[model samples]
Target: MNSHTVRSLAYLTGLIIKSFGISLVIRSRLGTGAWDGFYVGMAGHFGLTVGSWLIILGIFLIFFNSFLIKSKPNFFPIITIFILGCCIDFWLHFLNFEPDGAESQVLIFWVGLLFTAVGISIYVQGQFALTPVDQLMYALSKRFGFSLMISKTIGECFALAFAFLLHGPIGLGTIIFTFLCGPLIQFLIPRIERMLFCR
Candidate 1:
């Protein structure tokens, strides 16, 4: 494969790791941050494990993405995400990452969620196939020429609403994550890209 392709794969691999860590934190059930709050809530309502719900969400996004993005959808990230979710579920099942109980679990959850945002930034920097949520923003941006920030805001608002209707966890953490994640991802994307690909 070309250097570009190889770099993209490496970045995707990193994303899986980061996503898995976030999943692990969620299953710990101490406390979840904003996005995780929604995810966990959806899982609870559906009687699905958090990891399974994540995989389902990723798969659903993959389907939605085919119609939403400039780039043709690829199954690699979806497949990778599913595998990572399963792996994370297993890790949480067997490992005790949170020993201090609820409060400490919340601390770890936030840390993991931050890392999840960072992971997504790195993955995007790879410039591989966009994930579903990203694809939606991309489609909107291309269709209306919305700024990236604007498109992202629109998408997040929609996600917030949907998650809320599903009784997904919306709280102070959700607001914090919604506001901070965009800027944080924006900051990390370029930095990780430069660090890894020197581009």
Candidate 2:
């Protein structure tokens, strides 16, 4: 396969991995990533699949990101939206196993976090389109000269505030994921880039 084919595969694979991780995190009943939590709240309070909210909010971010970077909005991540939304719903429904206790829940949370970071890193390396939320990090980084880590942390904080207002599940796991995700993505992306791109 050519580079494009490889990238498309990686992109799709990463979305699946990320969605699976998201399902596990939600199922753990601990907490979820900030934006995922917001989506959860929206889905619970309003009516729609979590994926549906992800897509809707992501569309809003497209213009938000464009305004930040002072560029024409990129519609590429709309693809990311549809694919990821569908996959997340699929995993959320398909996975029927539940954590039996706090220890199990914590284990699942950590595992899910790991999968999420890895998936985000891998799909980013695909060099197609970053998911809209992830793209927000890039926009902020470009506009503000923040590191990816800082950019991501800031973005999640904004999402967290909205999640709180929306009455999402906010707890230890939410805080942990918020703090860890940025560093993990920072640490993993370079390593993943090397693995995928370095000869």
Candidate 3:
């Protein structure tokens, strides 16, 4: 295989790890960040799997992002989300350990959170398609002439509102994770790149 193909496979492996971590976090019953919670909430209220909702939302965002950026919709990331969605379902199905107590729940949450962060670092650091939600963030920033921070805040607020409406788990974990996740991913990215010898 070509180097690009090898890199793509590695990125996909990272996505599988990330998806597994996401399932663990969701099953912990603590809470995830807004976008994830929104997907989980849809899965619970509607009649689909969490991974299914993830793909649906990702697809919806692809169009929404296209509208915002005034560009043609890129369906390439659908392939990425499809793998992620399947991996999430696979992990959710096979992961049979339920949290025995609050302590165990916390343990699961932290472990999953770390894996999620590291997996994100590994894949996102590579030059490849990212989630449509990420594209939405940039689209919003450009369309409204807002900064990335402001655009992300707007996206988070909208997602949080929708998650609340869906009765998704909105708890301390979500709040703490919102604060912790970005910095953790940022910290891990460079180290992971060095380890992987990626640019």
lDDT of 3 at 149: 53
TM-score for each of the candidates: 0.74, 0.97, 0.86
> 1-199, model 3: which lDDT tens digit per residue?
5557656766887898788788788778788777788988898898798789989999999999999989999998898889888998899899977789999888888888888877777776556877786666678879999765566556766787888899998877777666676567657767877766645
User: Which 10 successive residues of model 1 have the least lDDT summed?
Assistant: 27-36
Q: Arrange candidates, best TM-score first.
A: 2, 3, 1
Q: Which ten residues in a row have the lowest lDDT in candidate 2?
A: 190-199
lDDT of candidate 2 over 129-152, digit per residue (tens):
889999999999999999999999
* Winner of 1 and 3 under lDDT: 3
Better of 1 and 2 by lDDT: 2
- Report the alpha-carbon TM-score of model 3 versus the true structure: 0.86
Once superposed on the true structure, which residue ranges of model 3 sit more than 4 Å away at CA? 1-6, 140-154
Report the C-alpha displacement of residue 153, candidate 1, in angstroms. Answer: 3.2
Query: What's model 1's overall lDDT?
Result: 0.65
lDDT of 2: 0.92
Residue 181 shift from truth in candidate 2, angstroms: 0.5
Candidate achieving the largest TM-score = 2
Q: Which residue pairs in candidate 2 collide?
A: none
Best by lDDT: 2
Give the true-structure RMSD of model 1.
3.6
